[model samples]
Target chain A: MAFQILLNIAIAFIWMLLKNNFTGVEFAIGYIVGLLLLFVLRRFLNFDFYFRRVIAVFKLIVLFIYKLILANIDVIKIVLSPKLNIKPGIIAVPTKLKTEWEVTLLSCLISLTPGTLSMNFSEDGKTIYVHAIHVPDKNEAIKEIHNSFEKAILEVTK
Target chain B: MTEIVVSILILLGGAFSILGSIGIVRFPDVYGRLHAATKSATLGVICIIIGTFLYFLLVQELFIGKLLLTILFVFMTAPVVGFMVSKSAYNVGVKLWDQSIQDDLGKAIKKAEKKARQ
Candidate 1:
């Protein structure tokens, strides 16, 4: 991962020198160009892992932003409503995520959502404790986490 | 042409900021307020940053690096800071809403205390 990042930065700087523009748009374009170059030269450069990781991170960010919009709208609705009909409850979500970085990413994603907050890990770290503001059903909540946040994190990380 | 889009973005950013502000003020307790403060407020800031970036890009014809950096920094840090603040709050027993239906952490804290005592 570290080596790939250095390679990417190196490519970006090379791109900057080639393009003769150091602006953000140029930098972004250069980055994409660098990414494509890496991808095309994947076998030669042995940068397949870096290439995949970059793409995965991009997809995760897109997914997070899309969900973030929904989360904002959902929270705004709940807040603007007459009766604060929130069924706030804590649920234990079993996680396949093991490593500290992945777990931290997962918890931060969970916490960023509108109504949910990650509270604690179980004694074993197998189960994550989450508090949702309107958890009408525990199973549904768990499934949602599994399908979206956990799945996205899994794809981005190892 | 670009003016219309920039105006729309600015308005949307303002609206998000307003909505989040209302939520922070009106939401019941620390936990509920956090719901607004973290998610909505962060989104609000992002929207504003994006709007500012576009404005700088389109109007001034200067692609400033600092605005982009600010957006990137906020994206990386806001959720993290929010998570830490709320986690510490719960740990130190800042009250959840009166209507909160679960106390999983409370039980866990109690169990840990009992284990520590023994």
Candidate 2:
């Protein structure tokens, strides 16, 4: 716990330094505020095996970056065509992620991507309804979400 | 010359973003607005980021790998986020303001229900 506090302080200090505005008073205040928030949040959320989850989150972030670049190219093609040939539709993506936070993050990721939009989650949270601008194959699209986003989420949460 | 090109890209990106926001405000339906915003916003953001990277390269004579990382992240996530938002809106009964289309989803749901019953 003490190590975690030190790590957070170090990170905050580095960030402040990078911005070239590191005042001692400001650093101390910011460090304390950040530490307190982390401590409180830690008590509230039961993230057992913290290091593993953090690593998984980092991996997901990396994967998301890779996907973002590809999606941009896809969107550009769709936009520049003289006659728009988009096959837009809604799909029910069955989510295996258990936690609300994981589901929310996955949904947010889905929404952030250019061609896909998260329409809704079922009442029981069994499925997420998503609308894709250019879904060539529904099964393939659902599989992509399940394998890419939900799989990463399951790694973090479970 | 490179600086001018970078500035032009940055300006173009800003223009795209502004046009997207306008589309969002002006478009009749949630889906239409989303279509406008997501595509334009992504392009705009990418242009701006590239411009920044070029500027940094000119000034510092070194590339910042992290800017590329930021671009990659934005490119991947924007569409997925857009899809999710539109889906959620549809589920909550947000209707198209203009009335000139068939809901293929509704038809598919009905067909699936019939197949399940058999």
Candidate 3:
């Protein structure tokens, strides 16, 4: 709990430094105030497992950075193609994960990837429907989501 | 030199956004158009935010935190919005063009119906 608060303060400091705003005194006072508010909220909400969630968020940041670089390359290929060589369609990808947060993260990841967008999820939460922009192979798309994003999400949440 | 790069990125981002808007107008169906709108528009906004960050970084020798915050916010929100729009469009009975192959959702619906009756 204390560790999480410290981590949040460190992150806030870095963010403030990057922004080139706030002097030393200002940063210290602001951080302490923010940390107090956060701690109060956490206690009021009875969020005992916040540390694990924070770690998961950190992992997600790293994963997102890696995906962002790959997505840029994919989008470049998409833009430069002479013919709009796209076989666009929506695919119903089955979700093996159970939690709402895990499912939502998977959908967001699919959408973030250059060639894919999460179209919908079934009411029962059994499947996610995604739209692929340039699906040369349908099976490949489904497999990618199932193995890549969903697999990572399962690891983080469960 | 830094200013030149920033200008170029800004121009490119604007161009991508314009192309995305054009796609929304030109694409045949709701799904197809949403694809264009979501992908290009999201990328466009990202690029613009990145360019702005770079501009500030070059001038001030520090990153702008809000740029990352903007990226995070867009990354979170854009897809959910896109998903909602597409789902609503589909639910409202927007039909795909004749050329579209493999209606997987339709097949799934049929299979579910068959199972439900039995």
What DockQ do you compute for every candidate structure?
A: 0.61, 0.22, 0.40
- Better model by lDDT, 2 or 3? 3
What TM-score does chain B get in every candidate? 0.90, 0.89, 0.88
TM (chain A), candidate 3: 0.62
Per-model C-alpha lDDT, please?
Answer: 0.81, 0.72, 0.73
Q: State the lDDT of candidate 3 residue by residue for A8-43, as single tens digits.
A: 688668757766887877577667666666666675
lDDT of 1 by residue, A1-158 (tens): 78777777789888898989889888888778877777777787654557677678899989887888889899999878988888787777889998878887888888877578777777777878887889878889889999998888888776
lDDT tens readout by residue for model 2, A1-158: 45665666886786577657879776876676666566567766554324556789899999986775566556556555556566666667887778787787888787756577676666677777666777678889888888888888888767
**Considering only N, C-alpha and C atoms within 3 Å, which residue pairs clash in candidate 3?**
none
Each candidate: RMSD to true structure? 3.5, 9.2, 7.0
Q: Give the winner by TM-score.
A: 1
Candidate number of the best DockQ: 1
Which lDDT tens digits does candidate 1 get at residues B1-118?
8878878877887887888889888877777777788788777777778888888899998888998899888877876776677778877878877787777777777888999999
Interface RMSD of 1: 1.5
Residue A73, model 1: lDDT of 90
Ranking of all predicted structures according to lDDT, beginning with the best and ending with the worst: 1, 3, 2
